[model samples]
Target: MSIRISAVAAEYGRGLRRSLDQVIGQIDEAKRTGVDLLVLPEACLGGYLADLSDADSTLVHDDPGPPELSVAGPELAELAAAAGELVVCLGFCEIADGRRFNSAVCFSGEGVHGVYRKVHQPLAEDSYYSAGSGFAAFDTPVGRLGMLICYDKAFPEAARALALDGAQVIVCMSAWPTSRTGAAANLADDRWTKRFNLFDAARALENQVVLASANQAGRFGTLRFVANAKVVGPGGDVLASTGVDAGAATVDVDVPSELAQARRFMCHLADRRPDTYYPPHSMLSVS
Candidate 1:
């Protein structure tokens, strides 16, 4: 069975009400387009922080944190209601047990299905939120699904772990920005944007699974986001893309059949040699 999916590359500011309105509008559009799954950028609900710089240790230590909301809060409940039967995956700042986490939540009219806290943090983001312990896949309306937030997709092991656990579709939500040090004259020529696209294709190709990636757009604080939302086929083909702009990339694909075809010749997951794998330093010493 084929399922329609959409990845949104849009800007979300610090206004909670405005952000929620945008999400509802997106859901309305997704429903009209018959989108079974809608993926939104990281921190789409409450918005990410202005700067992630740790240049001044004092400022890093003294800075106020992201706005926190409960996964079971009214915000998510409203989102679930707005989604109706359409499955939606969106990033938010989650507050659980008085602690804040950079989290992504999946839900429908039936309510929340799964939640994933970001495990890998670039720069000094760890100073703001705690890291997630592990990765896991869960059943969703579209397919067996896995989720990765921003920097989590940078690690091959994270996607591999989820694929091994039976994830057929992986959605990566990112608030990725343009170059930090050397600014690019054109946003399209930004190196970070290139890396974002490369990682999405590489991870999908290596895992033999469908990949849907959504990212933030426009500028927020010191960061100019790279809006390159796209859906990649199991064979690492770009099924649909929004390019480097604020829009939605939508595609319809038979995920199971695609996975089967990609793995037919050589199943990357099945062809494993874990026993021979050793630490890099240990391997060098042995050689």
Candidate 2:
């Protein structure tokens, strides 16, 4: 009952055609490798912000931000066609009702399974993109899947909500960069990269669910991305990883069986005392 899953670390840019060509090739390769699900880096459809030097600059990059596309756009349809039997999750900038948000969509040949707007924005990201409000899981061919974009994974409640709603596999897409002020000499030693990896492992361990973490790699604008895509087992163990380089990592996992085993002795989710917990949404932004 094990399903093969792959998480990718690669560079994508402003050229829509190039991105599609690369992704389609990846999808075709995954099909050959028997991958049931494929996770792509954030903004793979277009690209991520090039610079964040001035926090309140109100600029996505030196150029225009990645094309604002709708979920119903033809590009996604093209991707869906290529997906065929493989369920794929990837990110992009979404334009809805004249406002733009960071979004991810999961789909297969059957059609779109789910869409998740990133609920958490880091630094001055909110100045460029509007925030999403919630998290939910949806049925997919591989299993019940939940998706998060970039900073969303940094919040425990974001993944926990999906886990509670029956997500067996969680896919997180990011264009995460190295430290803004003080970066490590090596990409591997970068503090931001460590936090990114830690969040992927901790979220899976706490939720008792398998996790596929995909991230952008190489340099984009003024940012140097930390490419460390990986597949983590329910016990927080990284089964496969691309390290700090641009590559894809794959692993076979019997999600349900592993989830059962992880929760067999200590059921973290079931043992929760909601009555004793503080309200999650009580805090408001100071600015």
Put down candidate 1 lDDT per residue, 1-287, tens digits, no spaces: 99999999999887888999999999999999899999999999868877888644435444344568998789899999989999999999888887779999999999888999999998867777777889999998778999999999899999999999999999999999998988687878889988999999999999999999999999876789999999999889999999988999999999999999999989999998886675433445553
Global local distance difference test of model 1: 0.90
Q: Stretches of candidate 2 above 4 Å error?
A: 55-61, 279-287
Write candidate 2's Cα lDDT for 178-253 as tens digits. Answer: 9997899899999999999999999999999999999999987888999999999999999999999998899899
TM-score of each: 0.94, 0.94
Model 2 residue 135 distance off true place after TM-score fit, in angstroms? 0.4
Return the lDDT, model 1, position 230: 97
- Most accurate candidate by lDDT: 2
Off by over 4 Å in 1: 55-65, 279-287
Error of 1 at 202 (Å): 0.4
Could you tell me which residue pairs clash in candidate 2?
A: none
